[model samples]
Target chain A: MKLSHKELEIQSGQFGEVRKLALEHQMQVGKFFDAQSFVEISQVHIMADTEALGLAGIEYLENLAQYPDPQKQVWVPTITDPRGSDFKSFKKIKQNKRFVDLEKRAIDAFKQLNVMMTDTCINYQVFMPPVKGEHLAFGDTGSSIYANSVLGARTNFEGGPSALAASLTGRTPMYGLHIEQNRIPNKFFNFNVRPTNFSDWGALGGIIGKQMNSYWDIPIIYGIDYKPTSDELKHFGAAMASFGSTPMFHIAGVTPEDHLAQNKNPKMNNISLSDLNNFYKSYLPKDDNLDVVVFAAPQLSLNEMRILSELLDGKKIHPKVSLLVCTPSAVKVLCDKNGISKKIENSGGIILEGVCFYNMHAREIGEANGWKRLMSNSAKIINILGGYGYETILNSMEKCVISACQGKIVK
Target chain B: MKENVYFGHIGIGEPVKGEALVADDNFSARYDLDRINGNFSRKSHKLFNQSYVNKILVLNVAKGGVATAWMFRSMKISKICPKALLLNFANPIIAQGAAHANLPLIDRFESDITKIIKSGDIIKLFPKEGKVEILNEKSTN
Candidate 1:
């Protein structure tokens, strides 16, 4: 990898030890990918949940945070993804004290390093949305895919360490999605059915993701007559990224880069209505004894919050079922101010802020609460919870709410 | 039996030698593993329920989210991580995680690594040199 004079200086410790360490790590990754040079990044989103960052990771951050050198801080605007626990509702979710303490320690460390605690996977929806062709180091797969595919920004699926490295140095190695040639469509998908609900859209993404499983696959989707909402694309991209580790995709006449699909012939696969049904069938609930129904993964947008609030109005969740509604702090604040939180809470639902369900010590919480059969509207959450020992079922928001009321699988 | 060797792109971390756990499936520390148990816990994974601790995990590709980047270090700290990773294809998340954890990882081989390597086969990995050598062919079965 070719390093610029500034990069060389950083590598030589002209900057603080923190910057040197960050640069060295970046260089190793860059060389692995054969990156040619470094590209200046405008912003970075770091994923540093306590669950992902265990004691060693937290100590690593604290060690970097203790650096007294002024240059040890992040070079560009840096933000965070969802935290491991929401302090206000950790106990409600059965997360122990140790988990909460670890979360606080991680937060303090990130603050010392000058990172904003956005605490969101839906940063593109509630936080600063990246512009077209802008360079960023986004840590969340959902965020990276949304920015790369929907907003036309350039980024790879930067993991926590790599994103933090980019933050410290204000640049990332130029490779993968940062290059133009790599973004061109290689796999094509012909969409025959238009999705009616969020889960349908997510199922669509999962079907395509299962087929285009490689990180290098750039799938171009076609046959959509209407423009899908941002929330719809959010579920689609989030599920696709979760299921396949995919970073970017394009929807003809819908997403910004559909023009790239023209004149380019790639292997074509058709996504039919039956494909979506089979996807939902694969995750069908085995029994009616539902322990929990969750609405999260990418977290809920304000519009989603409004929709959920309406669905839960005047209906009480069954005594045996626990309903968890997760959203970013920004959206949660709006929900609180507008009484959306109260409406949902009135119906026996708990709203967790600033933490996605899967990252918040999910396995431990499940064990503590004796939760086994889990239901959620988000395809991304359903796909992830399986490894956490949950018999996850995918459904629409309406069906999930109804199931929570009946305490069983409605369908 | 002949000693077989394969070359791949130069990779990250120290050279290591360990038993191989080969699978023709993609990997994700968050989605396909039970980190606390040190086993492949995802039911759909080809190596489901198999213990991966300290073995050189040979897989087809890396898949799923960026959590694996932080997860590798966490798994290493708990001493439950694979000894090294040898994949036919590696995404940035795997490369970044391996670099962060300093776990030996080499990928981008000319052929499928899972088919070339067998479970329980003793193998030596030279990550920086981009070399993998299978030892004790008798154990390949």
Candidate 2:
């Protein structure tokens, strides 16, 4: 791979050991992909939640922080994905002190590296939005999928280690979604059913993701008569990336990358409303008693928060059921100022900032709280939590709120 | 005794020998694993309940989240990781993970590796050399 003079110098340890190490890591990755050169990235969003990082990952960060020179700090603007738990709400959520200690250590190490702890996967919405054709190193799969398809930014599924490396070096290997040739549509899909709500849109994405289930296959979907809001596509892209591991996609007239599609013909498999109904019905709970109802996985946008707030107005959550709402801290601030947070909290729902449900030790918490039957409005969350021993049910945002109130599946 | 050798793209980490755990299904540390017990925990996965530790995992491709990259590092730390990975194709997340964990990962073989190798086959991976030798014939003799 080609390296600039400064990169070569860093490789030879003229720069600090941290930069040298970061460059070495990037070089090895570049070789793996046969990347010819590095692409300068504007910003980096790292997904290093404590659950994924573990002790070794934290130790690795701490070791890097031991570097004396501040030159070892991140070269470009860098932020983080959602944390494992919100420290302010950890006790309320029954998170043990051990987890909190580890979280603190990880945060301290990141602070030393001069990384902004945005703690959001929806940084495209609240933080700096990636511009068209903008190169970035974003770690979260949902974030990358959205940035590539919706925002027309260039990135791959960078992961935590790679994103951190890119942050330190201010660049990443020019492979995967970074190059234009790889972005063309490999599969075509025409939607036979128009989605009515966020869950329906998510189910549609999940269906298509399963059909074209690979990272390399970019599916260009056609025949959407209506426009989807950012929040709807947020759930759609998140579920698609979660279920399929898909990185980039195009939606005829919808997404930014749609124009680059070589094939304009929508002569692929068609997805109908019945297929979506079956997809949702496949997760229908056998019993109505709910252990928990969640509104997260991507964390709620401000619009989603407002919708949830209005849904819970004057409704008391059943004592047997717990309603959890996860949102970005910045969005949560807006929710607080606008009284959305108070309404949800007053109705017995816990609104957490900077932490999603699945990544926040879902298995341990489920076992600790005896949460066996979980209901969520998120197609992405239900797809993930099933492996963690939760009998997941998929519902619309309104149904999920109603289920929380009734302490059972409403339908 | 006959030796069957298959070449793949040059990969990371040192060459090593281990029994093959073959599956046509795709892999993801975050989506399809119970790392604590070293087993494929996702029920829908073909290798569900199978141990991945100390084995050379042969899968078709990689799927799902970027957490796999960091998960590999922690799994290595806990000594519950596959010795190496062989895939027909790999996304950047798997490549980055293998690099971080320093695990041998060779992909982009001429044919579907999952079909060529079978479970319990003794295999020697030459990552730097981009070669995978099926040593079962030699071992039986």
Candidate 3:
């Protein structure tokens, strides 16, 4: 890969150890992917949850924090994805002290490097949505997909280290999603049913995700009757990315990229309603009892918060079941102001900010709380929690709330 | 010494030799692994309950989660990780993670790596050279 004089200086340690490390990290990733040069990225969203980072990752950050040069601060406007533990609710959620301490240390290290603790996967919805054709260094799969497909921004799956490196260097290796040639759709799907709700959208996405199965697959979907809401697309894109590791998808006449996609109909596979039903049915629990009900993964948007509050209002969650509501801190403030958080909390649901359930030492929390059976509206989270020893039942948001009230899934 | 050589794309990290733990299933450190135990813990995974420590994991592809990129580094620090990863198809996350962890990972082989490699076979990786040698194979007879 070719380097600029400024990049050479950073590599030569003229800018200090932090920039040097960042450059080396980018160069390593660059050479691996055959990136010819670096592309300047406008912003970066880093997924540095403490669980993923662990003590070793945190210690690595602390080592970086030891550098005193302010010149080593992030060159771009960098924010964070959801943290592993929400400090305000970690103890209540049964997260251990070690988890909390690691979260703090990681945050401190990031702050030292001038990274904002936005702590959200839904940064596109709450904070700032990247514009069409804008290049970014985004970490979360959901964020990358949404930004790429929906908003028409460009980003590959920039992980914690890569995103942070892009932050410090203000540039990322020009490969993968950064190049325009790779954005073309290879797989086409024609759906039989029009998805009306968030769950339907998610269910459809899961089927497509399973079918696509590879990161290189860009599925251009057709036959949707109407445009989905941001929240609906959130669930859809998040589930697709989670289930398939797919980065970008195009929805006919809806997403921005669809217009740029070739007009010639790529050979399309017919996706029937039964496929969606079967996908949902596959995750259904055998037993009726519910240990927990969660409303997160991509974290809740404001509209989702409003709807959840409306459902929980004037009702009580079953004593035997625990309901968790995960949202971004910024959105939580609005939910609080709108009394959405209060309503859910008053009905026995815990509204946690900045941390999704699966990333918060899920296995340990489940063991500590004795929670083995779980239900959630997020197809992404339910798919993930299964691996963490939870028996998950994937259902619609409405069905999930009803399950919370009755203390078991309503079959 | 019987050896069958296979060529792959230039991978990350130094060359190393270890027994193969081949599976047709896709991988994600966040979705399919118990990092602390160095084992495949996802019940539905093809390699479920199998220990991956010190082995050359030959798999179909990488699936889901950007967390795997950092996870390789975290797993490496604790010494609870596969010695190398050889997948038929590689994603950006897998490549980035391999770079971060300095874990030898080669992908984009001429054929399905999982079909070529079998469990318990001795395998050696030459990352810079993009070459893999199946060092020892038991005869079918």
Instruction: Pick the DockQ winner.
Output: 1
TM-score of chain B of each: 0.95, 0.94, 0.95
DockQ, candidate 2, comes to 0.72
The digit string of per-residue lDDT tens for model 2 on A271-368 reads 88899999999998677879999999889999999999999988999999999999999999999999999999999999889989888888888878
Ranking by lDDT: 1, 2, 3
lDDT of 2: 0.89
> Rounded to one decimal, what is candidate 2's iRMSD?
1.2
Q: lDDT per residue, candidate 3, B8-120, as tens digits? A: 88888898999999889988999999988889989999999999988889999888898888899999989999999999877888888888899998988888888998988
Q: TM-score of each candidate? A: 0.98, 0.97, 0.98
Candidate order by TM-score, decreasing, is 1, 3, 2
Poorest 10 consecutive residues by lDDT, candidate 3 chain B:
B1-10
Please identify model 3 stretches exceeding 4 Å from their true place: A263-265, B1-3, B139-141
CA error at residue A16 for candidate 1, angstroms: 1.0
DockQ of 1: 0.81
Report lDDT per candidate: 0.91, 0.89, 0.88
Shift in Å, residue A148, candidate 2: 0.8
| TM-score comparison, 2 vs 3, better candidate | 3
Model 1 gets an lDDT of 0.91
